[model samples]
Target: MSDPVQLATARELAAAGSVRDTLLVGQRGGYAVRFKIGAGERTLVTKSGSPRLFTGIDAAARVLGGLGIARYRVDSSGLAEEDLPRRRRPDRAVALKRTHENAAYLEFLQQRAEAGRRDTVRYTDEQVNERMRTLRTGRRA
Candidate 1:
């Protein structure tokens, strides 16, 4: 059915002010509704001037549909995943391109590191050995 007519029907079914509240009130995950009953999750839906406990949103929807209060019924057990369009996997060409890009970046970093080490100041053999020992042990030689 059309959106506007369907929304109006849903609002009347839930006794809510707006369409958003109607959907919120009809929390269909477990098919349960949160209408004002007492003070908790349990809510009362009046039928024929008598207050009745609505067991599930599906049942409420059925009653509303039977009474022409709702334009359509929602399937509680339907998988939302089925409604989504299938996603295409990236081909081998794209995967290989990404790997090549990563390898090139690593080679650039390696070259920069080697250049940094080569540009470092040179010291005497004995001083170099002492510096290496200090660096390896993280302490004075």
Candidate 2:
């Protein structure tokens, strides 16, 4: 067994009751004191959405096999945890609902416009009188 790596950061984090969020980065005695002893601990310690459990070597293997940790270092360029490519959108139910709503609104607008045009035939008496006056003035009827 080796010495527990003097992780000041981890120690500080553990001291601050951030044990749920922190991980010992180096070896602790013989086993790595990483988040690999329990599933709950692993999930809590891992970068969000990674599948690697806190089971040490097995979890490390999974990490190597495309199960990413999404780690980054301040000094380095950092790793690119590429998203697993898949279909853009599987569900069009909302879009279809919107389309139907738009169509209904459009139909209502069209009907209202048609009704307005039809109603214009029943002009006011003042407008009829004005038209007659214009005709009497020898304007193009």
Candidate 3:
């Protein structure tokens, strides 16, 4: 989204290898790019014929191509959703596992909640306004 970030990413891709080796570029409804860096995966998407997106992509591709890192390509057939790696979904087992891991913290939170209810403070409207004024103006209301 940010120019610097996009450029940095392009540079990384360029450094990795040839564009043809690193990127799976396609064009269908729009432009789609799929690539992986380490274990992290990313996809860059731009609407077909979008001036801004095209300009940015072109610049990036030119820089990368000039550096001999990658080649950009456009294909009529786009990447299939099923071909992309699926994100891991946390199920009930995961929730239970996390709850078990945080058991002590959960108990502490429960205790704190009980204590908070027992120690509740009921302030007069003027007292509340005074506190708010102090917070706002950094002086006694």
Which number leads on lDDT?
A: 3
For candidate 1, write residues 1-141 as lDDT tens digits: 111233234346456423222221323233333322223222223334223323455666665555344543334454343443344667877999999999999999999999989986877999999978889898644
Quote the positional error of residue 60 for candidate 2 in Å.
18
Per-model RMSD to reference? 16.5, 14.6, 19.0
TM-score winner between candidates 1 and 2: 2
The lDDT per prediction is 0.47, 0.42, 0.52
Clashing pairs in 3: 17-69, 18-69, 18-70, 19-70, 19-71
- Lowest-sum lDDT 10-residue window in model 2: 72-81
TM-score-sorted candidate list, best first: 3, 2, 1
For candidate 1, give the lDDT: 0.47
Backbone clashes under 3 angstroms, per model: 1, 4, 5
Better of 2 and 3 by TM-score: 3
lDDT over C-alpha atoms for residue 93 of model 2 = 70
Of 2 and 3, which scores higher on lDDT?
3
Candidate 2 per-residue lDDT, tens place, 1-141, comes to 222223343344444544443232322211123432223443222234332232234444343333233331121122222321223563687788889999999999999999998885687899999989988888654
For candidate 2, the C-alpha RMSD (Å) to the true structure equals 14.6
Total backbone clashes of model 1?
Answer: 1
What is the lDDT for 15 in model 1? 62
